[model samples]
Target: MENNNFLLKINNLKTYFYLDEGILKAVDGVSFKIEKEKVLGLVGESGCGKSVTAQSILRIVPPPGKVEGKILLHQKNGSAKKEPLDLAKLDPQGKKIRSIRGKEIAMIFQEPMTSFSPLHTIGNQIMEAILLHQNVNKQEARVLAIDMLDKVGMSNPHRRIDEYPHQLSGGMRQRGMIAMALSCNPSILIADEPTTALDVTVQAQILELMKDLQAKFGMSIIYITHNLGVIAEMSEEVAVMYLGRIVEYASVDDIFDSPLHPYTKALLKSIPKVGKKAKVRLDSIKGTVPLPLDLPPGCSFYARCGQAKEGICNKDTPPLLEAKEKHWVRCFLYT
Candidate 1:
């Protein structure tokens, strides 16, 4: 997406985890911008650092995991100059980052059960988020929480507000998590595989709910998922990541119709399509993701890239080159 109206600008972000063997570059030099009220799809296989990039924006990486590079937040004031708060430079316990967590930037995790407090009632958790972010009384927070629950399409929201997480259905709990995330009307929302654990029908329902809420709230979204189908439904612009770097980025239609990068093409071909001659075979990418600690010297996908050239692909890292207007890919073939 265009960076002119950017809400969150992440430049060359590197989040490294210090391990016994060496530093594991979970997110290495990842860069992307999310514009105001736009959806940016981050599609990749498992361990491709999509989730790590989202977490880095919020500065939520656990201990021994260090993050670097500029994370600029564009304020609502319509100024080109970014807020002085560099997310990477913020102290872990500082008030600036803490103040922005639930209010300015919120995240919806893959599993709601794991995120929710098992002992606490759903109402209590949602109320806590509201109360912490806004200077509202207990009664006001409860009312706001119930209103949010209703907004997220929960049934009998007032009654369900008092119920524990275990009492709600899988879809309901997912809705509840979305409700909590939106309670403060954050400027940016990072949804990390929000529908992964739900049934197909429920997944559609949750996706619809998220889109509706996005329209209502006008918040930027960073949708991180492995499913290209979900990316097609939710995002306007899509970035295909391999290993720890973005291999291709373009509008959703462009990526799907004319994918430039070999990895992106392979992923699209691997998807099962209807109305096609039923093949006893399905396309699959060979090999597994390389270990983060000992990534290949050059392009991480060189080992499995069918289009890889002998010396060029394995000797030098390819820069992200423009393939078309507003379309970019990292490969020697294009450069």
Candidate 2:
């Protein structure tokens, strides 16, 4: 059931990839929702299906992989009261999804160097995006692209529009990517590790820019990142993932102040506090994530969880149960 208050609601989404070795369950039974104009931070370690989840939402899973389950998007707030569309059932290459992808839902990928085409100028790429979704002439699209560039803090927007991806610095390239993603004025933005390769200062600047843009556009955002600091700074709500499932979901303050899952606790403990003693070693979660091809039948975190019990955690996979008001944790400890 799609809630009218939610702009996007994902119900038990399972994206799996079939390979010569075996089936890789990249995203298994994940469900969440993004309210209108709210930022939801998806935090997890590498290979935790965060990126795959985002790609599945946009129907961009590559060949050999298939996405299952409901991804209901509520098309409210526009001129017409359009019916709720199930993105999971839509054809990936069909015109309907294509029109919805850029115009309604946009994404900022991790690496800008690879995201931009080396052959085309920045202006051409952005203008093409605008022309694809909106009914605009080339000249009008060029002007809009330049305006977007200027809004994203690009210096000499007219000159920068003609520049190639390699011509700009790392920060500038990221800003250009943001500009392109926002050019279509999407209703929802998926940011997947947008500050991965930037320096600390530039990372702050980019984060600030995203906040400013979100306020200006009043768009809902799904911010995917491993950095707890970034999550604390950018998100109003937080969902912590392990393996391919969400282990904990709660408000940002509750996540940091009263996390229920062991995995979430370990992640928070790993972050170094600003005024803490310098000589103290940072805490780390023991054991690595199990291989996706051979996932255990019980709790996926059983091998790594220090609080795992013999008969409970090792024998049964706990469902995500509500422990507090709007706080859900997938663990027997909470149940």
Every candidate's lDDT: 0.86, 0.89
lDDT assessment of candidate 1? 0.86
Q: Which ten residues in a row have the lowest lDDT in candidate 1?
A: 273-282
Q: What lDDT does candidate 2 reach at residue 54?
A: 98
Can you tell me which runs of candidate 1 are displaced by over 4 Å? Answer: 1-4, 76-84, 272-283
TM-score of each: 0.94, 0.95
The TM-score obtained by model 2 is 0.95
lDDT of 1 by residue, 1-335 (tens): 34456778888899999988899999888888888899999988888888888888888898799999989886555467655356888886789889889899999998999889999999999999999989999999999999999999999998999999999999999999999999998989999989888877788899999998899899989998877777888999999988889999999999999999989888787653321222212247788777688776778889988989988899888999887999999999998
* lDDT of prediction 2: 0.89
Lowest lDDT 10-mer window, candidate 2? 273-282
lDDT of 2 at 261: 92
Candidate 2 C-alpha lDDT tens digits along 1-335:
23466788899999999999899999999999998899999988778899999999999999899999989898645533566789999999999899898789999988897789999999999999999988989999999999999999999999999999989999999999999999999999999989877777788899999999999999999999876768999999999998889999999999999999988888888764422322213256676776688776789999888899988888888999889988999999878
